[model samples]
Target: MTSSLRYWKKNNLTYVLHIPPHPIPKSPQASPSKTHVPLRPVSPLQNRTDIVVDHTKWGKILGRIGSESIHIPKVLSKADVHTLTAYIAYLTSSGHPREVKELLWALFPELNTSKYPSNSEEHSHRALGRKGLLTTYRRAIFLGPVFLSAVLNALYKSNQPILADRIWTLAKKAERLSWARKLLPNVKPWIMGPHAYTVMINCYSSLARRQYWRMVLRPQRLNYRTAIASVWGTLRYKCQILPRPLPSHQVMELMHDLMRHAALVVFRRFMNLRHDYAEIPEMRRWLAEKDIPKPDARFFNAALRAFRPRTPPMRKSWYRRQLRDAKFNLDFKGVLPNSNDGWNGSLHEVAKNMIHAGFPLPPGLQPLFVGRLRGFDLPVVHGPDRGPFAYRPQKIHPWLRYRLHTPKEKGLPVSRAYPQFREVLAQRRRHRRSRKRQRNRRAEQDAQRVAPKVLSL
Candidate 1:
């Protein structure tokens, strides 16, 4: 027993052998055991790679994707409308009255306003008042049954003639004629000078309506005096009045009827006169009949000499010996003067005939005779080539080579003489300096690469 106990203690045999087994108990179903699965650790290098990809390339892709989703709305808010309205109002109130009216009309079409609305009596009075047409605000407002009393009160109270004139001028530019006419009467007294009356008549004349002219002439209706008075006034002021005066009513009517015929006759006479000067015999006869004074002897001789053809007179046998020692050709032959007699008559005679006939030389020839006489050289340039040195010299600087080749020749530096050359040298030096700096940088980089860094503990 003792040995068995010792053996049990030594080997734990009893606990191992103490299995209680009886009748082979049925085996229970085996249960599965739970097992723990360890998680894999993320690498620091992998996190760095992800950040680099996002920062370098993927970040751009994400940004573009986000930007594509953005949208902007398109509607003008109340502030925008107010701003536009203020700008338009400011532009309208500042001397651009016509444009202001136009813009207002465009904005409010229901105003039933025409730029010149003759049908509206209130508008007509306003237009007239603005143009300074009425003789007085009271006359415009009260005298005329079709006037706007309230508007006249406002315009008359303002009583600014200069401003009214400016507005009237603007109205004229806008073709508000009826309105412009309204201002005529009131401004007439202020504009009593010649310029004023002329402008008034011109305004009526430009209408091209005979009725308007008659209206202006009639003292009863338009209040302008007689046509003669109008002309006298114009002359007093040194102004040119049109519709030239006629000697009689009969002549005026006759001229009016024959205007076209008169023009045709005048044109035909002008053309015929232009052709008459070309015929030499006819020109001389006309000059002789006119009894014109002759030109001075010197002038006549100069002109005659110009017309005479050069006959190589120096080359004649007698002159040959005289000029033989000279270094010029003395050739002579059967050369004779040209027989043209066109310029023989005195210029004075020609001029008198031209004056009597109410014609002058064609404008082209007038300048020839009236201007410089440089072109009046003796028409016939004769004689041989005159001298050995007839032609001008060709070689300009023959001494330049000798000066350049001299032994003591000191050369000027190109940069000293030419500023452009100095600039070029400066640019070249800068380029060399840049290259040297780049080379130094590369050498430093190489040295750093070859050198070793000591590790700190």
Candidate 2:
């Protein structure tokens, strides 16, 4: 509905009234031409579309920053790197992992470069190349701990432990030990989520093992794990004030896995010193006090395998006892005799090692070692075998089960991808703003029409 107003004044009196018309409904598609921009409405069902759009927007911004040169570190200043950090965090939170990888790739194209030739001339070039790569890594570190932690988590989810450790080293170098110690607890909810913690555990443990091997092979260089351990030792001591039992039970399983791996790494390192049986009991007590997950059979097997000797040491009996205790613990605790995942062969290998070491096999463990039993024994008889097989379907939690899987989201409509149409669209926006003048002129004409009516009245 619309109304027109008219006013008339005579001497000391004035009157005004408006002629009104009945309300009229406007058409839904009335100015379709003006509303031609092809904006896609995000569907709540598939979040990936929204993630892609946001990633694309930030990626374009980063791309523009890198457009000046191939050397991204040289091109982008510290402020720009900080800005990219927020974008990285957002991508991580979205859970659309590919976008994060793509954004990283866009910014760091040098990661894809292959190894250069090995000539002396090329050696100099290679050195320069290494220098350039280090500079870029410095830029990545400038993104700060939060972003680095997110990258570490993503790398772990993608099962790239090697890259995760490299990033961890880069993070340590970029940020001071004191700063990380102070910041880690505060930023943990966002940066040190379960995935990040798991990756950290994996990184520390693997590095510790590598350091032990290096000491065995080349004692000339100081152990690499010692540096990491020193930093962690300080952090752990400072972190005594941290609350126990993390908030999300959803990730408790993963958290336990992390703790178990960390425990094994520490245990393995201690055993590597002199096949120390004392360290095992101490480790158990230490882990218990720390509220870390108790070490499982796999942990014990890993420790045993690490000490498998070419020539038997004086503590051979002690090592055998450790294996026996591990077997006893496996039986006592009723932990899975073998891993559910087909990938794990450590338990079997350790059993064979024990047999070869002149140690008597634990009763009934021989069948498991021989591959007769796969895992937990189930009371099922398949076909006519009537055999108790080691197979059982796991019970999934109600929250973990889902009937609807998220469908993949489609990208932007084809119309927006055309350059000519985009240019036209820009021109249309300009003209749309210019139409304000026409609207003003129309207002002026309406005022003139009302004035003539008022004069006649």
Candidate 3:
């Protein structure tokens, strides 16, 4: 018998069976051949002494990259360690911009450096360290708008308006106007400009559209939309509190300019097909309340360009409106198509050049311009079509062109008598027959079950 095999005594039977040693053997001093070996513990903490804790090299690298003031765990739990390992392993997996701020909050709740007062002089200056601190910082640009506002104030106090403007641009891109509204007072005359106001109005309109879409899709989440409304209200209230807020007329002028220059941003949600013609009255009423005038043909044309042709009737109505608007004089805004050169050029400059070059009037202009152009017999300038300035045609593959252009008759093989085709037809016929029989049987059984009993009674 092998040395590892041993016999165990029971009642006095002559049978033999192999037996293993005790799970925890005696000490080495007690037995030279066998020594005690530690068994697996029921609780993880029971074997805590056996486990070694160390900072992950990559985690250390990330720590150096992220904000030093922001806390990152030195020793992670098993779950956190597993999560960190997975995050590292699948490094290419991406998160949406909307979730970035939430992720920062989830990872580190104490990342409120912006909440500190700016008047702290030296201590505040030290806390405000390098801009690179936020480059890899766990927090997102949107959530750091307050931090940006504070930084903008500091930049302005230090006579760095250009840097402050750059920061404002970044905050605008992140769509954090709620935080940005706080900086408007300090920024002063710059924020009162038409361009800045246009951007702000566009931001509000975008938020309104987003909230409106959410409210439509989820009636139960109405509170979220309400909260967005409250935020807007808060913004307006803040403007009122400003020592020198832009006048109400200036606000109206800003809206008018935005409607003329960037109508798509203002009217898309209100005018799109997802909203019905029945809502037009409501829209008009709302516009009147907001002191926004009815849009001209140019504005409608810009707005309609953004609409998908998914609904033919609504799209047809939009085209009709565009035609009606074109009956008046055309005073176009923004860049004309087909010429990238004229974008930076002023309206007067473009008109002067067109007069000098004798180029035909651009489309989407009023009928009067068209009439004048037709009468002049000017050379037609075949520039890009007038529509949404951002629209670009998607490139299609040559190989897939056949699939798109192929006729129904050509889609299927002409060889219908092939074995595979025959098999398919045979299966379909069998399925049809089976279905008919099942229906007939069910009918007969149901009729019999429903029939009255006469003689049996």
Candidate 4:
């Protein structure tokens, strides 16, 4: 009864306070009747609703660049590209990945045009410095790859490899076009950096990872595992674009880490998280083909770990770190058979490589040809005090650690396609060719309509 009385009181207050306003009195005179003009019928697919983001709103979002209103423009322009690219960089770096993904998707359809407006092509403007020296430059602040790898990275980050690959292809095409046209003889061709190659390598890894994982949880069988895997194998075919950074101590460490990641690819065979098979020799060939780090202790150890059996009661996640590493009380002794036991095929070959890689082993384990496994714990960390090094694999975020499930995160992204998956996956690329084809089809239809109108006239 008390609850019913409270509800009645709330309703009475709403009724008293929220009465609808009456319409205002208007002029009694009727307006003139208007003639109707024929118009193009709108399609359900075409919804052109443009919302202009005011200066204050965008300024706050982009952080103190002064007042600049951002609106949807009809043509693809350099200013739009530069602004959107800058916005993407800010989103990725600021750790607003969701915003980054959204901004990328929204901008792709807007920026996927081949045509730049005439006026927007180049504008020569000068700004005055304190000493009265002039600065002639693009006032809109446009500096990025012609293909927009930033957007490509964004797409990859969102797990859109199919789209990202299209962006990469366009980037190569643009680079060639620049060279063929000799547009800027002075400027060197735009080549992707080390990180970009690594990202592509990682992207292929992810595609394979997805296709593989989906199969396990699947209702049926699928192809495309070999398709994605081959992408990595063929990466170095364009030898010119591949980064060959001088292997300083830092570079060596980077290469070594990448080598282990390659081994990881071997473990899973690029389909899913729990591996399909461990292909050791294929990895060595990949490393050699890329001409990066050679086999090291850590690399071989990773290969051996990849061979760690995924049996019942022991998780695939459990073997993420070195199974032989004493850090988790998982020693290599458990997996090896008695010395009298027979070993065969690729298993024998990988074991030999691991032995040579200075991997530790227990008594009575068969050490493969031309290599010896030491009977002690190898140092957990490799390298000097401050160079590229591996430390204790912390689970606070990574044992594929994702302790927090909220919008605000704790630890690193879980191990999915590649290690440090988030690091490799960056900005976006779009399905530009498909978009362009659709736009052209629409234009052709418009031309057909206009031709009929002209004939009638």
Candidate 5:
């Protein structure tokens, strides 16, 4: 539940808007963990007719609520909260971006709940005392990792970035309550775990990818793609801090399993020249670890793409063999055929470069790029009869390639996520400094203005 407190000076009143948590719905990629939400079976009649009718009816109902302040005659109960969550999930999944804002508006972003008892078993309709509400600094957080991750996923799939951004912003801001003194509890689950941040990152990556394909014939905007990379990088560094952040490919698999699309992040990493050197070995070791969960073949396929000139022949052959033998990867999950890479074989000449560069190729694969593959190659994927980029591969620049080795602690070998992790620290430092400057400037201006008042007094 996302609950917030607001003080209204007009009537000397404060309201705590408490939105309760909803049970997780069944999804195609729904985790094996049991969900509180019950499965509702749909017959063909309901699926084709009833669902459409209900979806349309709700769409109309939501549309009618334009900018109007809604009044709940009664305090929302657990049942009410579940209903709201279910409706939101249903509407969101139905692709009804139309009046979703109105639906969101109905979420009680500004509910007056101060007079009610905080510890009350029920959401009381009657107003109560103020002192109790004012004295207590702690706020209840009902938004769990499970709920938030699901909600974020639904919002993104529904093309509700604005709502998604607002949720993310709220979750991020909950880190610090600048207005009040107390810290929030259990906030990390909302923002960090469950790929909540990754959902948004994947959204940006998807957009960037669409732009790349749209501009294949024309001169693509390099800076635009660079900006997208920077944004996702900053978020990964700032918002997500796993003691052991999974490598980019694992993150990519999580995305594919969740969203059913190939994430460009994996491709971008594969195309990085230095990626094969630093990241591939780390993946190999990670897979070899007995403690880690059984390796997914999709993950193995991703590693195969990381092969480059510097990669040892033996290791390359071994990776190919691992991919070839299905038994090695254990039980395979997710969409059967290459949905992770959107079922596309070519990206920035990776397939082509690997073949021509003397790297072992998995069965029935060929090179798609010509010349020296380096520095940000735009994927020129086409239908059947596909050829290489016909020129040398243009890979993303290796600015971070010139690194001085610094030894680290024992566990979890430093993989590709290290640079972004480092950047994230610097990014936080820069943010703090920037904020300090703004705060000081505001304070100085206030002092300067107050100086004349002091002199006059």
Candidate 6:
């Protein structure tokens, strides 16, 4: 029982047995492990050392070359630097190469000095070439118009007139006329600002041409066809006379000449028309010996107003009467309108007389007369009851009247009705159908409830 109990205790209880004492262990001395052993030194390739030396020599040589190449000698003087800066500024502002040259010459008189001096012409040419060098300077510094003007002035003062003229022309053409004009008087004292003068003359000449064209062609209703044709004809004739490649200075002169020639042509055409009426003895006598009507104050005033150097009140009625009286042919119609005849009959008589007087309808303008005739037949509406016959000769159409008279609120309702009134009416009809169906269903239900039901056996 005791052995069994022990076995049970050993097996079942799993007893923790005690062991006898053992000696304490000492730590081992530190030594290099096989896993952590140091590796042997690697020998570099023999050719690699030579390569490294060659690289070192190459680096030194390249460094020396770079140092030598980058070093620049300061040969320019303090005065030279200032002169160059001023010259560049002048070229940029004035836009003239000649001015640049002159400025350079003024600043650096010794620039032209040589053991053997060149001829005056050669020297001048050389000076111009040097001025052109400023263009390079201009490109570098991005010098603008202010600097260009100063440069041009200098060139002009140096007696380089041709170069100055060329530069001035280019500058004027490149810059806006307004800017050039403002700069002109200031720069003119130093340089020849003739291009500014040319621009002004050309502008005035163009205005004159426009006025003359308007007077001759009489373009009604802002339709510029006649004016365009007249201007084109004038330009064609001017081109034939002067041709192209004309210098800037000569364009104004050419335009003036063309204008004078055009005026003479118009005068001659008027004279030829007057000569046609000389067949009649009285007309011939009048042509031979009649005092030309002297232009009155009104005529001079009209002419001056047409030119319009200043704003003035126009005498529109006087000009209109002049245009009417200028009609040469007249047709006399003697159809006495009866007192009972309407105003329409008088209008018809006047129109017939105009047609008989050889005043044929103008080509594109006939449609306007046709439109007016059609308009006369349209019924005019005054108010709701007093309409369809209350036609004022100049009254507008009924559609236009409705547009002018309709009140904002009464016009249309907000919602789908504003966009499409018909769609709103359709939608209202659909809603009514749905309501009708619902009412019929309710009536049937009420009938069922009221009627008696028989029970089946």
Name the best candidate (by lDDT): 2
**In model 4, what lDDT does residue 331 have?**
41
Candidate 3: clashing residue pairs, number: 1
Off by over 4 Å in 5: 1-83, 97-99, 106-140, 172-198, 212-457
In order, candidate lDDTs are 0.31, 0.44, 0.35, 0.38, 0.40, 0.36
Ranking of all candidate structures by their TM-score, best first: 4, 2, 5, 3, 6, 1
Q: Would you give me the overall lDDT of model 1? A: 0.31
| Candidate 6 lDDT over residue span 56-143, tens digit each | 5665564345324565778954554446657565555455544466554454343342422222248776576546434333331332
RMSD of each: 36.2, 29.7, 21.2, 27.7, 33.0, 31.2
lDDT tens per residue, model 5, 1-457? 2222111122433222223344455786765443343333333343232233223565445433521357876765555445655766676667764455565444423312344433334545322323333222122134333444556667778766546655554444442232222454333312134245456555544443331211111122123322233333233333233354545554554433332223434334334423333343453232232332222223324333332222233444554453444333333542132324222443334444433433333322212121223321343322232224343332322111111112232334446699999999999999999999999999999999999999999
Off by over 4 Å in 3: 1-100, 106-114, 119-204, 208-238, 241-457
Decoy 6 TM-score against native: 0.17
lDDT of 2 by residue, 239-307 (tens): 232343223332333333443455345453322422332334452222233332333323333344332
lDDT of 4 by residue, 323-402 (tens): 33322232433444232332344334555444444443311122221122343334322323331223333332122111
Task: List clash counts for every candidate, in order.
Answer: 5, 0, 1, 16, 15, 19
Worst 10 residues of 1 by lDDT: 1-10
**How far out, in Å, is residue 32 in model 6?**
96
TM-score of 3: 0.24
Per-residue lDDT of 315 in model 6: 52
Number of the top candidate by TM-score?
4
lDDT of 3 by residue, 85-183 (tens): 344223312322233334334543433334432223477554553332333232333234344333333443344332333444444443332223342
